[model samples]
Target: MTKSPYFPQPAVASNVAITTEAIDITTLFANAQHATAGGIVLFSGTVRNHHAGMAVAYLEYEAFEPLALKQMQLIVNEACSKWSLSHAHCTHRIGKLAIGDSAIVVITAHAHRSQAYEANQYIMDRVKAEVPIWKNEFFTDGSSAWGNNTPPINSK
Candidate 1:
């Protein structure tokens, strides 16, 4: 079998990555720390026990690594350019994951809390909508389905 490109690796200063191993939030957060940053925000997306009222046993994530990583980097770069951020990073996990496992993480450090918070949210929203990652939801009843993981946007 061919080796997967999503192999685990030590967290570095990369802006984005798709890994098959568990996400190292500590390292990512540490790397996002900046002396000039007055506000730092981290967002971790975890696998929950339930989804859409169904009892989810577990989840499996797969990604088109080439495109996923590229898109992820673009998202992070966009956030950085949009805000006066001192640091920004994002990491996503693939492979089988149990409930409560961290699926993804985004960290942003800015001069103010508002920008940090908004940039972090913006990155997450773009990733969910544009990334080539797919999620499989396995239910307790032995049924499984490719999840519609994208959140609906409000049009007002």
Candidate 2:
């Protein structure tokens, strides 16, 4: 059987992938679980039907897969080190995606729930701000444009 593009071997804890297929959130959760893990957090970023009051038709994502995966791995490694995580896995979907589809998933396991939650959020933020993935939004008005990464208004 062919291995998932995300995790080629079971020995490694950090897993990252840039795929065209739908993300398997269950597999990511399982991969993030470890013997010493007391808590697990999973985050899924889904495509929505509306953006800035405009009706979104869909989204198209493109990335330099090699560079994207490398940057993702770096984010996971940083989160693991900062939180003393037991395991971490993340996957980002590329290509065309419909509304309500999961575009990305991040799973983190740690000895504490707080650590798991914080690390999961941190990893996602870094992925959004630092990863090379680019998203183009198609609006119902027959217009499309590339999306930019803007920090949340409350971001510190």
Candidate 3:
């Protein structure tokens, strides 16, 4: 059996797409913190300039609102089932965003480092893969690519 100092229990999750303020990371950490064990992992995705060799000047994000939120909830449910994560939360951003802007954030906690690490990866992978978010990549030459940004249908 794996040895973890703490055990992941239940968690509180939130899903939102906003154009304003960056995620309050401190709050997310506090939500995942538990007195049971130790370790907490936080993952953040940002808008970067360059995807698949395209000189991305900027990125515009959009979500199918209702479906997108539902899919995000599904991701959380999957993470809970797969990991001993005590708590988890995620947020995604939409609208116009320049390079360096925060795109998403996920925080997971467990009793040990490995659990935290694994769960963190699981959450990010699932969110990117399953959530029906869309991204438009604007190139420096004024070209753009638009399509579903979902990561994949399955991950083990």
Candidate 4:
């Protein structure tokens, strides 16, 4: 297996590609404060082999690094302000990935299920709609296409 890009620590609660070869979901939950929270929502987006019934073999992703990171930070900042969310973090995978690899993970903590669920949805939705990240899909037929768009900034 390949080592993770995140080192000593996973990112703080924010929207971005996050990993903790040392810090993972369990670690996040452990670090999360146990308040009067009644619910927690976690969302994970993974690589699948089929899209629109076409067999996908793999995928390669690239990003306008500086801008993409900025947008991710923005997403988190927005979320922190929009709800009673206690803690939220978003992590996405970069570089080439095979089928079944995890592409993203979003976690939210709230005192109520509604807030957690809604915030989780908003985080993922906004991440896809605003982040300057692009994916090049590799098909079984030896073909590729830019996902969303090239430069990724177009989607933003």
lDDT of 1 by residue, 64-125 (tens): 99999999988887788778577889899999999999999999888789988998999999
Badly placed stretches (over 4 Å) of model 3 are: 1-8, 12-20, 147-156
Candidate 1 Cα lDDT to native: 0.84
CA shift of 127, model 1, Å = 0.1
| Whole-model Cα lDDT of every candidate shown, in order | 0.84, 0.84, 0.73, 0.70
- The runs of at least 3 residues in candidate 2 whose Cα sits more than 4 Å from the true structure, single-residue gaps closed, are 1-12, 149-156
lDDT tens per residue, model 2, 1-156:
985544312224588888999898877777766776778899999999987777999999999888889999988988877777778888999999999999999988877799889989999999999999999999999998788664224322
Clashing pairs in 3: 6-111, 8-86, 9-86, 128-151, 129-151, 129-152
Question: To one decimal, what is the Cα RMSD in angstroms of model 4 from the true structure?
Answer: 9.8
Residue 26's lDDT within candidate 3 is 77
Clashes of 4: 1
| Model 3 lDDT per residue over 1-156, tens place | 884545455554533343346677777667666776478888888887777666889888887778878787777767766775676677888888889988888877767778778877987887777777778888899888784443334412
Off by over 4 Å in 4: 1-15, 18-23, 149-156
Q: Which ten residues in a row have the lowest lDDT in candidate 4?
A: 3-12
Q: Which pairs of residues collide in model 4?
A: 17-92
